[model samples]
Target: MARITAGIATSHIPALGAAIDLGKTGEDYWRPAFAGYEWTKQWIGQNPPDVVILVYNDHASAFDMNLIPTFALGCAENFQPADEGWGPRPVPVVEGHPDLAWHLAQSLILDEFDMTIINRMDVDHGLTVPLSLMFGQPQAWPCRVIPLAVNVVTYPPPSGNRCWALGEAIARAVAGFPDDLNVQVWGTGGMSHQLQGPRAGLINREWDNRFLDQLIGESDALRHIPHIEYLRETGSEGIEMVMWLIMRGALGRTTRCLHRHYHVPASNTAVGHIVLEPVS
Candidate 1:
């Protein structure tokens, strides 16, 4: 059976690539941002998993507001890098693990978890930005990726409890796979910041830190946090932190924090990163 070895949470700030590419890491504004992921990069180098199940939301890139699924799983052989307003990043297309993805999809649905199975789709910065920060643009990705795209753009999306339930379902699905492989699950987005309308550029450091503490130590408390409270307190977009609960639920109740980093003012967002190793 495959064991989930690691869990990671990260913020997918679109401008992060440009900041790194421009060699601005040493600059006052960007230095701390780059510093945050350094420990995660080192850990990956030492213990690279064979597969990664990445959970992220597409920002009206692949699935426009026209049609959105609360939870979509990618089972395609390959996925194209989306051409956002500027253009697609110069990186090799992401290859998916169809065998594992299909198995996960089938099992989750059988378990009564409604998931949208996507045979084909393109991914934007939501997925790529974290990839670049964690692994950089190598000739090819270090491991196969099972992309899980969540719908947070629509007015009403999956609730925090629902996302956490999905995470538990995912853990069971991965554990049941017959293959002998190591897998890492990643939840990307949010640390209390908003983007949109006049409420843009909002950041609540106090709530952000408290959320992180509860996420790692007392996540069951998160289940009680209502959707309206997340919106009102964290900002509409900040509600995306609910996605992190999914990742947290997939790991052991007690996980060792391997790395953590947080920053603000990244194109009107608060960027945060954390890596965890399952505790036995």
Candidate 2:
């Protein structure tokens, strides 16, 4: 049966994608940020998974105000990179694992999670930036991807507790699959950032670090964090951090953090990344 081998969490800042596409990674302004992921790139190369269940939020690129599903699972044969204004990022098309995706969709829906099944949709930076961050400019991504787009773009996104529970359901579903596949669940977005309003450039390093600490050592408390605190403390956009709980939950009750990286001022957002595996 398929088993989840690990969980990864990172901030999916779109500018990071542009930096790589435009060859600005070596530039001093972006060098420090990209440098943080150098070890991850090498580490993933050594410990590649058969499939990665990428958890990220759409940024008005795929689903707009007209429609928004709290949890959307991609069951497509493939997903084209979305054209976010300045054309699609010059990256390889995202290949999907349809059989596994459909299985997960059915399992999750039966598990009492209202999952919107997506047969076709273009994935935006929320999904691709993390791939670029980990795999670099490969002609094709090394592993098949299963895009799990969470709804964090709009108001009243699922709570951290709900997201955490969904992750647990996902792990249960994956465990029941008969394939001998190695899987990784990745949750993307947030360290602390607000894009608009009076507190536009808000970022709380201390709070972000505390959240990371809780994520690794005290996830029970982390999962119960309310949305208001995220807004008041981290920023309006900081709510994106709730997505990380899903990855944490899927890793099980306890996990060992193999690696962690945190950097600030990456296009006015905090870039946080961590790799974890369940404690055996």
Q: Give lDDT tens digits, candidate 1, residues 4-39.
A: 998999988878877765666688878778888888
Tell me the TM-score of each prediction against the true structure. Answer: 0.96, 0.98
Error of 2 at 248 (Å): 0.4
Off by over 4 Å in 2: none
- Clashing pairs for model 1 are none
Alpha carbon RMSD to native, model 1: 1.4
Distance from true location, Cα of 75 in model 2, Å: 0.2
Which numbered prediction scores highest in TM-score against the true structure?
2
